[model samples]
Structure formats: structure tokens, C-alpha cells
Target chain A: MKKLLLATCFLMAGSGTLFAQKYMTRTGKISFNATAVHSPEKIDAINNEVANILDAKTGDIVFQVLVKSFKFERELMQEHFNENYMESDKYPKAEFKGNVANVGEVNFSKDGTYNVKVSGKLTIHGVSNDVTVPGTITVKGNALSAKAKFSVVLKDYKIEVASMVADKLAKEATITLESDLTQK
Target chain B: MRKSLLLSVLSLGFVTVSFAQTDSLMNMLNSGAPVKNEPVAATFKATRIIDGSSVENLGAGVLDFRISHRFGDLSQGSQNFFGLDNATTRIGLDYGITKWLMVGLGHSTFNKEDDGFLKIKLLKQKKTGMPITLSYAGSVSVQTTPAPTLPTGDTWLFSNRLYYTNQVLIARKFNDWLSLQLMPTIVHYNLVDSSKFSNNTVAIGIGGRIKVSKRIAITGEYYYRATNADMTYNGQKTYNALSLGIDIETGGHVFQLMFTNSQGLTDRTFIGQTTDSWGKGALHFGFNISRVFTVVKPREFRDTKATSW
Candidate 1:
């Protein structure tokens, strides 16, 4: 009877509250397909990373990007990409300010797959836009998986392409996100 | 006549004193004059593009002071410091010449090697219909090993890099204090030494910024260079690395902490030759604390406008 009580106490102590989970990956590719006849039908990694993703309860979701810290291979492309395209030095960073579901039970012990819409505002290149993305949260014992897919238009913000290679770029871009969460 | 002779001699003494002061300044500091050059700022990290839009050329001065440190280097021999086999720790000044042109000279504290580089932005990036920012950056570096291994007569080493980055906002201001920038990058290397340098490699990097206050922010990024970057040398298996870092901003000063799989921080050495997982090891732990100083005031003769152009 005493052993049974101890087990029950341990269960109660572990009940409630979603664990703080963080996921990270930099090898995930953010590639661009450019069709320049002389440039060949080639693809390139844009020196991008989803450094970290932190999830928790109480309606708090935060994200950050170090504007000046991206890397690439080609000296030519890297120079133009930074000096001409992204004004990283001046702005230095872009961030996401929003909340996860505040009222949800934030079930920590359940073993099931749940679907929810993650809504937040994304600011980049000095412009702000609102985004509502549909994603899934999976709970398997103590681990969680958060996944989402979304699309954005560059024109929504006021970023203008220079006249030289105006016709060589894309207008619409797709962003896909997948992350695994662990106990914080 | 005696009075005139004394006046001339005093004037000559003053001229000599002024010349000595100017020469000493030239030898002690990178920028002999305190006037900071405001050069064009174009960086290849794609997230910067997605966050602020395309960068234009401009001259801006860099900080006069750089506080840099060293942890340890990978197993590469000590001769490769700065264009040799490897290079570690670089701290120096940068001057922006045009809105799009920047030049800098830095020294590696580990090997007492020095290098100078020029960066240029090719195109003014514009937002796509969907808020996509694209840009390109190119730089050339001249690094010299403290001692040359290839005949003392050969003392100079050169490295070049070209990169492209694209950044986008996945979720913006869910409220007022947060935003996210998705950045991607590609770099190219030309003119690498055969002994320790790898062929041009492909890598990916991502970064983001979180704001806790109006003027303060937290920033981080990660980089993964492909293993294909390594070519066979004397029959050995080599691999590139994955690096991650963060930056804290307060006014004009930005403090950065970096954990890299490769210890060489210069463009040629780190990107060209990487060993050991900075991700798993303790030596790759590095930090760069940098500050940006702007030249605000000009005194009389220092201001060219004071003279007739």
C-alpha cells in the first residue's frame, strides 16, 4: 500500500503543464532554382537556417534571425546577395512575435495527433505581414512533432528588385517548417 | 637676420614634429585617421535580405576596437596560419568606400598573420510579389602567414569568395515584439592552396532575430557545409562542419557568440579546410564582440570642405 501511494504521488507530480521543447536543424535546404541560359539551370543554398524553435504553453511563441550571419559558397553570388539584396548590416535581424494557443489544454501526457492553426505576424526587410498557417502537433509519449507549410508574396512588402536582373528572380516563395520538440 | 633665422628654424621643427605624429598614427592603427568610412553594407546571409530589403552601396566606418579571443584549432599544423595551412582569430577595421564598396584589413592573433578584403554588392535586391529578398555578395582576401612555408620569398596568400542569400518572413509580428527571417546562402571559393584547402564547397545557413525591447534584440544562425567540399589529399577522409552562433545588440555595440565545427574563422581557412565537429567539440567555441563607430565630427582642416575643392 505504501509503494502504491509513492507511485501515485509521482504520477501526480508529473501531471499537467506542457514541457518546454526546442528543435534545431541547419542542413535543411532552402534552395532556389534559377534558369539563366549562360548561368546554367542551377540551384543554390541561400545561407539560411532554422537555428532554433522553442515551444511552450501560456500563449508564448518567439523566433529570431541574425540578419548579418548567413554564409554561402560563391564569392560573387554572396557579395551581390548581401550588398545589393539584403540590407542585413543595417537592420541586423527579423523576428516573429506571437503566441501559441493560450486556452488549449496543452496536453503533455496524451498520445495523439492534434491539428491547429498557428497564427502570427512576420516582419522582414522592414515590412510586416500577418500569416495564419495550418499545422499539426503530434504527441508520442514524451516527444512532440510540429509541422507547417505556408506561402508568401514578396510584393506584399515593398522589396524591389534592381533593374539589372529584374527578370531572373521569382515572385512567390514557399516556406515549409518541420520541427521535433523535447522536454525543456 | 637672426630673428628671421630663428623663426625659420622653429617652423621647421614644428613641421618635423607633425610628420612624426602622422607617421606614428599610420603605423599604430589600421585607419590612420579616426574618420570612419561608411561603405555600402551588403551581406550574403539571406535572412538579412528578407528582413531589411536590398542593400545599397555607401561608405561607413567600422569600430576602431575589436575584442577577439581564441579557444583552440583543429588538428591542422601550425604553419597554415592565415593563407598557409590555417588561420585563427581576426580583429581589425573596415572602411566603406562607396555605398556598395567596403574594404578592411585584419590580423589573426593566433599566427600574427594579416589579411585585407574588399566586398561588393552586385544588385539592389527587390521584394518579390511574395516578400522574397535576393542578393549577392563577393569578397577577396589577401592573407600572409607569419612565416612562409613555400620558400621565404613567397610570403603572400590570396582567397576569394562569392555568395548569394535569400530571406523571407514566415511569420511576422504575431504581435509587437517578434518576427522571423528565413535565410539561405551559397558561397564560392577561388584560388585555394592545394596543401590544406578544400575545393569550393556548398553549404546552407539560417538565422533569426528576436526583440525583447525596442532597441535590444537576440540573434542566432547556423551553417552546414557539405562533405563533398573535401577532396582526397594524401589519402584521408575529411568533412566540412556545422556552425551556430548568436548576437546581442545594445545601441551601437553588438556582442556575438559562435560555436563552429571549424575553428578557422577566415574566409579561406574555415570554409576551405574544416575538421572536427565544432558542434560536438569544445575548441570550436568562439566569440566575436564587435562595435560600430561612426565619425560624427570633423575639425577644420580634417573637413575637406574647409578647403576649396
Candidate 2:
């Protein structure tokens, strides 16, 4: 009976460790800036309700953002972005699924910061593209945080801007992401 | 030894189940779960579909300046240059107070009418569940035309020249290319020509848009007068209003070219006072031009003084 109890405790400890590798966050922040070089037009939006999950065991990461949740500095610009550019009604969410290229270099059990390369397929406006971006992952005891800055060309995602206002918008928009996650 | 073996088997089963749970977690992460109850948008591109009000509303703090022109009936022939020579115009400004609330004022050359209206959206269709959108609109109009002849002792009362309309608009977007709407409307005119004509009328309007291209749509609207006798002018029977148009959406403007059997633009006149018949070739060519301007800066840009981007 004592041997059975010891075996059961051992299995419980192993299962707990397996579940601790998954980290999740619901309140991640994502922002984008598109400032035209020649014109005075500046378009910027922020979306704070981003959900992301990371599996440290397999080095898999996933991100989801509701396109309509993005708020712009100008209400009219927001409307145009959703109705004309993003078509949020038809494609409501933008998602990414990728993996950490160098998962062996970082130790999730230790308190440290590691710069990593993440490669994934990002789907935006019903179009998917393979993307690789450099990001930093920070571990502080039980908490994990990640941040990245990247730029994407609008034409690559089939987002067409009319020539009338093409000068007012940048061809490439700079995007920044930050997330503070807790182990689940 | 047998008891220890059974315990070992149980521990192995628990470990296997826990490992399987991780696979399930990965599967859940891979499948993108759809977000629920997001409100559907852009069911109709413009707030007004042809001659009738659409289910759409302007964004908050936005102003819409609109000009509507209706030429004389095509049956007028070349003498009137196919209705090109005679034109009745209406100029209006609509303002959005909220996402679902709007107010507007308009002046029309027909009957020299001055009109104002308030529209409020009560419900919106959501992607997760809600199937239709509902809105309530109310309008008040006053005829400003001077009476041609008046008896010495008789006086014209301002209240008698006033007209009111109450309507409920229900709309549904069936798909990306098609949308339909129904409006149950009631119009009241305080004074009429005689007891022969009713003071109040009920109408049901059906309208739809079929997208033929990315930037153009074929639109039509018909209003059926369910109650009241038709008003006659020179022994001709007036018909219910019917309009067919094409909507072209430019970057910042929506231009609608229509052929309608009604000469008036206000709800009181268009809904209850149409005097032209389509079968008799009384269709009038008209166009509506809409332009929107942002009157108030957004909350983020309101306090910022940095102009150089």
C-alpha cells in the first residue's frame, strides 16, 4: 500500500509539470502605425484585447485578434479600415500560429530574457502568409512576457488602396505587440 | 505482489490520460475558435437607399451633406427636354449624434417644404445570433409655400400645414451580395384638400439591393399604400411610389441615379402624394449626391496639437 501511494504521487507530480508549460494571456496589446512620408496624414490604431497562447514544451505559439476591436485615432479612419480595407464583417479575426526557432536555447524554468526568432503563418483579411520576426521572451518566476516589432506590406495581404488616398497611407505599416502571460 | 501490479497499472493509466490531455490542448490551440456575437457591419453602404431611409446610420460626429435632384417627368417629351429643363432640388444636412442615433434637416423645392427627422437604431444584427436590424425614424415637415389665394376672412394656420411621419425599418443581410429591408410607415397630414382624402395614411415599403460589382449595386424601392383613397389631379389616378436606381460608391461619395414615379421627396408627399404612374411613362430621372465630413475630431486627436506627421 505504501508503494502504491508513492507511485500515485509520482504520477501526479509528472502531470503537473506537463500542464505548467502552457502560458496564456488575454489582455495583450497590439498597435500599428502608418504615417505617410509626403503627406500630413497619419493613421494609427491600437487593439488591447488580444489573446495569445504559448506552449513551452513544443515551442508552439498562437495569437488571435478581432479586427473590429482595433480602435483608431480617427473614427472615420477606423470605419474605412474595417469596411474598405479589412472587411471585418467577412473576416472578423486575424490569427497567427508559429514556433520558436531556438527553443533549446531558452530555459523556461529559469528567470532570464532570451531573444528568439518566431516563424509562422499569419492570416489577415482571409489571406495567409509565412512570416518570420524577431522577438524577446522574458521569464520572471511563474510569469512570462513577450514583445515584438515588425512591418508588413499591405499589398502582400491583398489590401488595395485606391489611388486617390494612396498617397495618404504608407505601403508598409509597422506593428508592435506586447503580452504579459501567466502559466496555465 | 498482485495488489502492487494493479496499482502500477492504475498509475500508468493516469499518466497516459494526462499525456493525452496535452495533445487535446494542442488541438484546441490549433483550431481557431470563432469569436461570438460580433455585430455585423456594412449591411448597406449608405444611410439612404434611393428615396427611402436605409438601415445604415452615420458614424458619431460625422456630418453628411446631401443634394437630391428630380427632373420633370420623362413623358413631358422634348419640349421639356426629357424632363431636363424642369428640376426640383432638395438640400439637406444629416448629423450623427451616436452610432445609432441621427438627426437631419432638409429643404425641398417641391411644395416649398422644410423637413426635419430623427432616426434611432434599436437593434443590430450580430454574426453570432441576431438575424435582423431594427430602427425607428420619425419626421416632421412644414409646407412653407405661400397660399396663392385666400378668402378675406379665412386665415392659414401653421399647424394645418404641418405633416408628420413615423416609421419602423427592419433589415436583413442575407449574404455578402444581397440585403433586404421593410419599412412600416404612417404619415399624417393635418389639413387635406377635402373630406374625400384621408388625413392619415399607412404604407409598407419594401426595398432591396443586389450587388452587381465591387463598387456598384442595383437598388429598387416600392411603397404600397395600404389605406386611404388616392388623390386625383385633372381626373388622373395617382399611383403608389416606385423607384429603381443604381448606387455607385466612390471613395468619399455615394452617387445614386434613379428613375422614380414620384415628384416629391418628403415622406408626407412621396409616400402619400405620388401622382405619376409608371405604366403611363411618368418616370422622372433623379440623382442623389452624398458627401460626408468629419465635424468633430476623435477623442485621441482632439487634444493633440502636433500637426506635422
Among the numbered candidates, top DockQ falls to 2
Lowest-scoring 10 consecutive residues by lDDT in candidate 2 chain B? B17-26
lDDT of 1 at B152: 60
TM-score result, candidate 2: 0.86
Model 1: per-residue lDDT, tens digit, B1-309?
A: 655565556556545533332123223222222332222222222212111222322233322344544456443435434223433566767555554566656676533445555556444332222232233434344434443457666644443222222222122222233334332333344444364654455555454555554334454444445534664322543345445455444322445565555555554444434555544342355666555443421121133321111
Per-residue error for A70 in candidate 2, Å, reads 2.6
**True contacts recovered per prediction:** 0.02, 0.21
Docking class of 2: acceptable
Candidate 2, residues B1-309, lDDT tens digits: the string is 887887879877876755543335445654645445766777777888788899899888889999999999999999999999988899999999998999999999998999999999999998767899999999999989886577899888889779999999999989878999999999998887667888888899999999886668899999998987475533566689999999887656789999999988888888888888899999899999988776665664566564432
Task: Report residue B62 deviation for candidate 1 (angstroms).
Answer: 5.9
* A10-50: candidate 1 lDDT, tens digit per residue: 44443323222323232222323332343321212242443
Best by TM-score: 2
Computed on alpha carbons, the lDDT of every model, listed in order, comes to 0.44, 0.84
